[model samples]
Structures are given as C-alpha cells and as structure tokens.
Target: MTPPDSQLPLGRRGLLAALGAAGLSASARPAPAAQRRLPLTAQTTEGPYYLDLALDRRDITEGLEGVPLDVRFTVCDTAGRPLPKLRVDLWHCDMQGRYSGFGEQGDDRAQSFEGKTFLRGSQRTDRAGIVSFGTVYPGWYAGRTTHIHFKVINGARAVLTSQFFLPDALSEFLYTQMPLYQRARMRDTLNSVDGIALKAGGTVLGAVREERQRYVATLALVVDPAAVPVIDRPPRPGGLPPGGPFPGSTPLSGARPPRPRALEGSARIRAMVPPRAEG
Candidate 1:
C-alpha cells in the first residue's frame, strides 16, 4: 500500500516551505501586497453537490457533532486591503462521508443523500475581510480525502470557488478514534494523490491546528475581483432554488480544473498545526 502525503507530518518549518513553494505565504508581517506580489487563490470545480441554498449563518452542522472546527477565511486583494461585504460560503460532508441535499451522489449521480441540508451555509465577510464558520472536522469517503468546499462572492459576482484539505494524520485520527466518523472507512487517497490539490499547487490545503478547545483552520485568499473570470454555467449567480438548475442549465462537465501560475520563489509562510492530544 502507498503512504499518504499527510503521513509525512509537517512541522512549522516544513509547512512554511510548502506554502512558500505554492506561492501562498508571502510574509509574517503586513506589507503592501503589490510589493510582495501575493498569489491569487486557485479555482476548482464546484462539483455536482453545489447548491444555491439561501442560507446565511455561521453554524452549518444542523446538529451533527464530531471534532469541533472553527474555519475562517481572510479575503483580501492584491493591495492587501480587506474585501468587505463579500460573501463566503462553505459546505462539507458529515462524519459518515454523506453530504446533504443530494438525491443522487458521485459523478454519475447514482446514489442518494437527499432530504438533508446539514453542513451547508454562507456567511458574509465583516469589514475586516474575514468570515468564520462553526463546523466539525470532515470525514473521508471512497474517492476523495477529507476536505471542505467554499466559494467567495461579491454580490452576484463569483470571486473564487475552491476547496480546502485537512492533513492526513488528523483525518486518520478522526476516523480511527472518533466514534461518529469511524463508521465511514477511510480511503487510499492522499493530498499528494488528489488531482485538484496537485493542480492547485497545494494552496487549497488550509493552515490548521487545535486552538484551546477546538480546531482552527485558516486560509488567506488574495483575489482580484475585477480579474476573476465569471462562471456562466447555469445555477447562475442569484443562486438556484433548492435542488435547482430548473432543467435548462448547462450540464456539469467532467473538465479539468484551471491551473494558476507556479510559485516563483522560495519564501516561507509559518505553519499552523493542531495541539497534541491530551495524554
């Protein structure tokens, strides 16, 4: 059996290197992004489960519980200025690897996880270009590793649509130790093996760690709202009704995700990791 990429464990130093190699971590102190040239967040497929639910809240758990995680995103522009009033939306599966509100699952849309709306919600960023969510650690499934999907929008315009990943070690611990998540068997995929992660150059992996009593994950997204290409595929901006596309929308295609520019230098960003478990 092949080893998982997360199994190789990254300390603060190593994490910084990865982020640097990906052109994500530019500085520890605040400086003009133009001077530092912050990289833009990479875009990924919205997948088949994306919905236009009219939800606006911080807690998307809908009552399921596992390891508590407070996910936050700092939305900024190339100038390092906060992008106030933009909306950030996130959705993920429960511990059982089952997503909500989908009657058909997977690419073929042959399975059902319908009648559920658990881990799906949107929160508008505050004046400081930050949006936070109260959710739990995601579990693994057959095809994909543990991850969370998110989108950033300024009114009707989509700024970025991407996913974030959890480290393999922590994901393994959750399934092997947590009763609720253990029900779904972990798969063989790793961050090193996930096509989207590879194509996005590791920027999709969130900087994560346990903070006090809960796990905290953060991602710094520098986006040029003016430059982000519009997504015209149906289920268009104002979002579609629950279980939408209303029949004439473009069909979800199996195309590859767009690849952004490669990292040009070797600068490093500090790493963040969860605290060690209590003995």
Candidate 2:
C-alpha cells in the first residue's frame, strides 16, 4: 500500500512533483510549516448562551430564514495531526439575534423560546478531522459583532471554547442588502471594536467564499488534547465580564449560564466517532 503524504519522504520539489503526478496541484502538498507544532487555538469566553443538546445532525437551520451558510471546521492537534472522534458543538443566534432555548437575549426579556432548538447541533470529525454544518448566516445583536460559538469535546471534557467571526464588510453588506437581516438596524459593534474578537485575534476569522446559493465558511482548530480545560466563570452581576456586553446596553440579567450536560455513555461516544478511513 502507498504511504500517506505525511509519511512520504519526498523533499519539497519531489513532493510537488508527486502531487502533480497524482493530479493534485502544489497547493495540495502540505506546507513544511504545517509539519511543526502549531500554536494552540486561542481560547475565548463562552458567552451567556451555550447548551449541549447533543443534536447530531448536519443541517441546523431548522427552517430559520436568512442567507444560507455552510460552516466547516477542521480539528487537529498542536502537532498538526488530525484528531478524529471528537465532538464539536456549534450554536448561534437567529436572524433576529435570538438564541434558541433562551428566553432573554439582548434587551428582549419577555420572550420565551424554551424547549426550542434551532441553529444549534453537534457533529464529530471524520478521519480527516473535518465536520460541516448546514445553517444560515448568523445575525448580529447589540454589544457584539456577528459570530458563531463552538466547543470541542473529548469524552465529557471540553478542551476548547471559541467563536468564529465573519468579515465585517460581508456582514455589513448582508445586514443592509438582505431582506431577512434588514429587520434590525445596522450592528452596533464591529470586529474591530468587539472585545472578544479583538482578544481572540485574526485566527478566529473564518475564510469565507460565495457559492451559487450560499456562503461557505471554513476554519481550522488546533488544540492540545492533554491541556487542562478552561473553566467558564459566570460574568459579574448585571453585566458580562470585561469587554462583554457593549457599554450602555441593558446589562445582562443576573442569570447563571446553563451548565453543559453529559453525554449518555459509551453508546453516545460511539455515535460521535466516524468510521476510520484514509484520505
């Protein structure tokens, strides 16, 4: 059997030639830098809204209306080796900037969406450490820019909790031009001013491209599987921690964020693991 590209002993030029002969371009060859230990993916606050519903499915839109978006994530270790069998949970607000299963979100207090689940789901990585979701472009809310939240889990422990940001220009265009996103006024915060975005740096920005009918956004997550999990402490009363809820906005009501639920057992774990295969 032929060895995998990573196992090949070809030099740079030889690797390029091998890729070309295999009908792949030079870009297909893994860069030499990728062979080194990559920096751990930056960690960010898990804002007030996060629920581990264990809904394992690809399409998370659940009929919510907005510009279609296909979000993809690649998970690998700090040494750049793909890590399969890890659960990735993604959740974002709807076009109206309201998260499912949460009654109160950014100035809306009387609304009740309890027991509702949309724009949220979990999927495990395949052999190549890739997972994809079918959803809509996330809407913006006060105090924060347009973004999506995700968590990487091994067993019951969450190794990383971070958010993905879209380009400000693209977000602005969608808010102003798209009818579905026009319900709200322009987003008050942008990537530049967003405290979390600024702290997380440019690494959180996903590479997005326009497809025929939807937008595709992709991000790479490099984590240290053995690293200690960061504890998510609740923000101060009546507001988020530093760089949290935009200034002058209604302070978030003092409610403890929901704690993540545990996966069932070995059965649940097995369901999250994709069948092993080589790329």
Candidate 3:
C-alpha cells in the first residue's frame, strides 16, 4: 500500500495563516498578518508546534474549505469510551516561539509563519472518537512555557504522548519571585519541569481547561489489548505509512490530492470530488 506521493502541491493559497490555528473575520485577507515579522525567537514550551492547516486540502488561501475547527475536545479511553479513529498529532509555537522548521532564521520565505511548518498535523477520531481544530489563540512565545502536545496513534504505533497546560493560576499570581514557579499551582506544578516537561514525561497536566479565543481539553490513553506493537511504520507526513487506519478511510498521505480545480472560481485551485450516488 506504499503509494500516495505526487509531490503534494497544487494551486497554492489557502494555508489559513500558516495554521497558527486560523481565526479571522471583519475581512478575509486580514490574515495578511499585518505584514508580520513580529516577536520572533524560540525555545518556548507548552509544546505541540501546530502548523499543518486543518485537514488541509492546502486550503484555498482563506475561503476556508471544509471549515472545521469551530472546536471541541476529549478522547478518553482508559475506561471511558470512544477511540474510534484515533490519530491526533498537533504541533505548536507561534504566539511567538518562532518555529517553522529547522533552526528558523530569516527567509524560510521570510518568517512570520514563514512557509509555516512545525505546526505539524493529523487528526482522526470520529464514529465517536471525536477531534477538533480550527485553531488560533496561541500568541506568547519568547522562551517557552504554554503547552499543548498530544498523541494517540492506536493502529501502527505511539499509544500516548501527553502535555496540555496553561493556568498555573496565571503562573502563581505572575510567577512569584521566580524560583521555578515558587509554590506552583496550575493543578500542582510539574514538580520539576524543564525544557517543556522533558519532552512530556509522566503525562503532564498543568491546567487550564478553557480560555478565550480557543483552548479545550481531555485526553487519556491505555491501549494494550494484550501486546499491540508491530508498527511496520512508513505512511506518515507523506501518506499511508504504517498501514492501520481503515474504518471510513483517509490517512494514507504519500501524496496525490491536488489536481481538480480547473474552474471553481477561475483563479485556479481544484481537485474537489464526491458526486455520485445514482440509482
């Protein structure tokens, strides 16, 4: 089943503002990012560097095609329920952690969200395994701390990879005299957190269930029906890698999608399908 790459680009436009989670109105082009290039550095935490651009047909420059990401949460399964199509893998950095790829310096296209990568992607979980993304609201990234990393593969590999924070009671009333967050709060500090909870050890849970612009939570994984870990691994970031997902389908990304738009609005961008069901 190793067959899905075509180079993966066609038309060129809809990146929902380089996927920092995309939230705009009052005017579509507002995402012009006001000429961007604002606060740009790195090392910040709160992890999960988001940038793939929701379900991504690569988007239509902003008309926002499928238009998902109104937002929702939870994907329990330790004793809970729903684990249906499990495959979440978000990425973050942008509220300032200045991430886009490699070390990130001038002209990756010219930064801002540069050609925008590192915000990573992937999302599945329906039939009840729910999932959400239409992101935006991440904005303070100078040198770390804000968090949102997640994992729940269930099919080929990775069964969990936690980290979801914000709300140390506002960093203990504005980081009391420092000392590593002094007395800590946000659901009892990481006890000893560093470099983003050490790449998320012990399933982090600092706090903050819901904040404005957007941020929600709920995650739990424990899969080990007996001993499930074969992982031939291969079909990711490209297409159909490990070969496990096949309920309704749609995950094998080696490449292909990016061809149809011959005259949707003329400007170009096509490859839209689905129109049969005859009788």
Best by lDDT: 2
**Residue-level lDDT tens digits of model 3 in 1-279:** 111223212222233223211111111011122354221111122222333344432111132111011233345443444467777666544333344542333212134444645445567767766766554323223223445554556666655544454432232222333232233222112212334444444334322333432233333333432333443332222122111232123444454322111122212111111123489
Q: If scored against the real structure, what TM-score would every candidate get? A: 0.70, 0.73, 0.24
lDDT of 1 by residue, 11-79 (tens): 533443434322332232235766886677788767656788859999987777667788989888877
Cα shift from native, residue 106, model 2 (Å): 6.1
lDDT tens per residue, model 2, 1-279:
122334322233342232222121011112234467666677888877788799999999887767778998888887667889999999998876778886655444456577899999999999988999999888877667788999999888889998888765566556666666775344556665567777887567777765656777888888877767765644532334222455334444674332122233454333223234479
Candidate 3 regions exceeding 4 Å error are 1-89, 92-101, 104-134, 137-150, 153-157, 160-270
Error of 1 at 23 (Å): 14
Candidate 3, number of clashes? 42
Give the total clashing residue pairs for model 1. Answer: 3
Best by TM-score: 2
The full ranking of all candidates by lDDT, starting with the best, is 2, 1, 3
Report lDDT (CA) for all predictions: 0.63, 0.68, 0.35
